[model samples]
Target: MAKKKVILFIVEGPTDETSLSTVLNRIFSSSTVKFQVVHGDILTRDFTSTSKIITAVWDLVKGFMGNIYHKNDICRIVHLTDTDGVFVPDKAIIEDKTIRNNAHPYYTETQIRTPKPDSIRERNRRKRNNMGKLQSCRHIAGIPYSMYYFSLNLEHVLHGKTNLSDWDKVHCAEAFDLKYGDDPNGFIIFMQKSSFSVCNDYCASWDFIKVGLNSLNRFSNFGIELPAVSQTR
Candidate 1:
């Protein structure tokens, strides 16, 4: 028997894996579905920059492939990321001294309130440039690659809320898993019919997200990647 090719998913956290892994595994049952959790947004990480983003991604794939899988064993790479209002204008960032800590930056449809507004502005600049670079990236380490976004975040897109606490994230993920785990096709249908789902055209979808405050609003192009199934299915 031939070995099943791997469809590796790169995501920022375990909650992403928890929320979508089972449904993805079932959707692409002919191949092996695996997730690499990078713990934080790779685009905004201290060690990464726009110029080094491709190499940084290559390193991530290499690290995940260590000793166990050959490059040829992988079918494709799917990178899932949160927009976090990265493309918003600097004026959309408001300084709120009452925010108390730098770790939590409050996000809304029109503005991001943070104690460190300048830092948030800088972070947005870096992340926007990095995302533009990644969007144009077609391949990494000789494997096909594509990146998708959940804005203002995965929780916002999936659960209709943002700024969720760690416990809330876990709870929402579990609920999502239960809803879609057994019926993978149902998950695809939901994505396809969602208000946040972008057009099927990949370039057009990315283009839509970068305009105005759309990045701060709920939007995702992920449904474009799902396999097309007949309505009768």
Candidate 2:
């Protein structure tokens, strides 16, 4: 028998990594496909600036690119990131389409790790401007690894809730355990009662996952596939 291909996944954090892993496992339950989840860094204020994010992602993929371009065994790659400051409707710094469209193979990779303006104001200005261009979503250069960003935040996307206070997220986790018993689909349902943003988020994720899943199922690779974006709401 031929060896199963390995699918690589990059996510912002462990919890989201775990969530995405579970969903993928459920989707590919019948296969012996293997998955690796790399802890991706979020480029928001907490993770430094856009330059750092770009450098970090470039470093990860440059290694993979060496192999992916030459090898036939590596199947695909999926990148997941929370729109920490991007999709905050009330305070969004990045546009939705900008994030979604960042993934494509045609764009040139820019060198942004160089020093920025000396003035803090200028540094921030440049950071904000450059972030809009890439959000450092450079994986589009990757042949099959699609760059995907979450709406608002991860918990909100996963739980289907929004404007969530830290306290609310903790409470929702408890409710998730009590009510859904760790069923990801059930957790998606929980996202429904959330804000409008979250509803949109669920739909966005459903679409991405559905496409990737179809590819998986067609080739016998993934899916316990979720419902259509419309019905999911």
Candidate 3:
């Protein structure tokens, strides 16, 4: 008998699929479990408005195992977006309507505790200018943290330096016009470099993928193989 296939769907971003693939292959190396990971091109601030991407993902998953296997097969779809105070509404739409018909599980999210859209640019610019001063202060204070989170050059709810609480909303990474855009690739790097990325929803999705793949590896039927080449970067 042929082995069953599992489809791992992800939202488009800088987060390398290679990491997920590598982890999956390792867990299922001895098992017959097979997985085909695909990404949905829903990268950007406009992702919430792009209902086409949602429909496309549903169509693909629906065709994979048909409605009959919908409840049986482990097809899954995950989306990561900017919370920007809009995550609740965005997720509600996907859960209640957009992907409600999808046979597989569907999820969406946004960054948490990020600077609001209106202030991200100014904050980044201020951070860039104050890097020298902040680095010096880090030595003096014997603690290292970016001054962007609390600086007069940037906006805040309090005087002198402001923390996360004063902001009215968080902005999507893309809105900052950062070098890497909002893709997981850049987000992953940012997550690696700063404390902020840990709070973001994108990393959470990646972590979940790791968990799902690990679970699937134990089920002895899918033939999973590692990627021929590992990450050099």
TM-score of each: 0.97, 0.45, 0.26
RMSD of 3: 20.2
RMSD of each: 1.4, 12.7, 20.2
lDDT (Cα, 0-100) at 231 in candidate 1? 31
Candidate scoring better on TM-score of 1 and 2: 1
lDDT of 1 at 177: 96
Clashes per model (N, Cα, C within 3 A): 0, 2, 14
lDDT string for model 1 (3-92, tens) is 999999999999999999998998988889999999998998884788999999888888899999999999999999999998888899
Which residue runs does candidate 3 get wrong by more than 4 Å? 28-56, 60-233
For candidate 3, what is the TM-score?
0.26
Q: Rank the candidates by TM-score, best first.
A: 1, 2, 3
lDDT of 3 by residue, 1-233 (tens): 55453433332322223223444333333422332233422222232233343344444445544655543444333222211122122212222233332322222122212223223333223323233232223211121111111111111111112222313212322223333332334433333333222233322422322232221111110111112222312
Error of 2 at 130 (Å): 6.2
| TM-score winner between candidates 2 and 3 | 2
Q: How far is candidate 2 from the true structure (C-alpha RMSD, Å)?
A: 12.7
What would you estimate as the lDDT of candidate 1?
A: 0.91
Instruction: List clashing residue pairs in candidate 1.
Output: none
Question: Across residues 160-193, which tens digit of lDDT does each residue of candidate 2 receive?
Answer: 5544554776666555455444354654444444
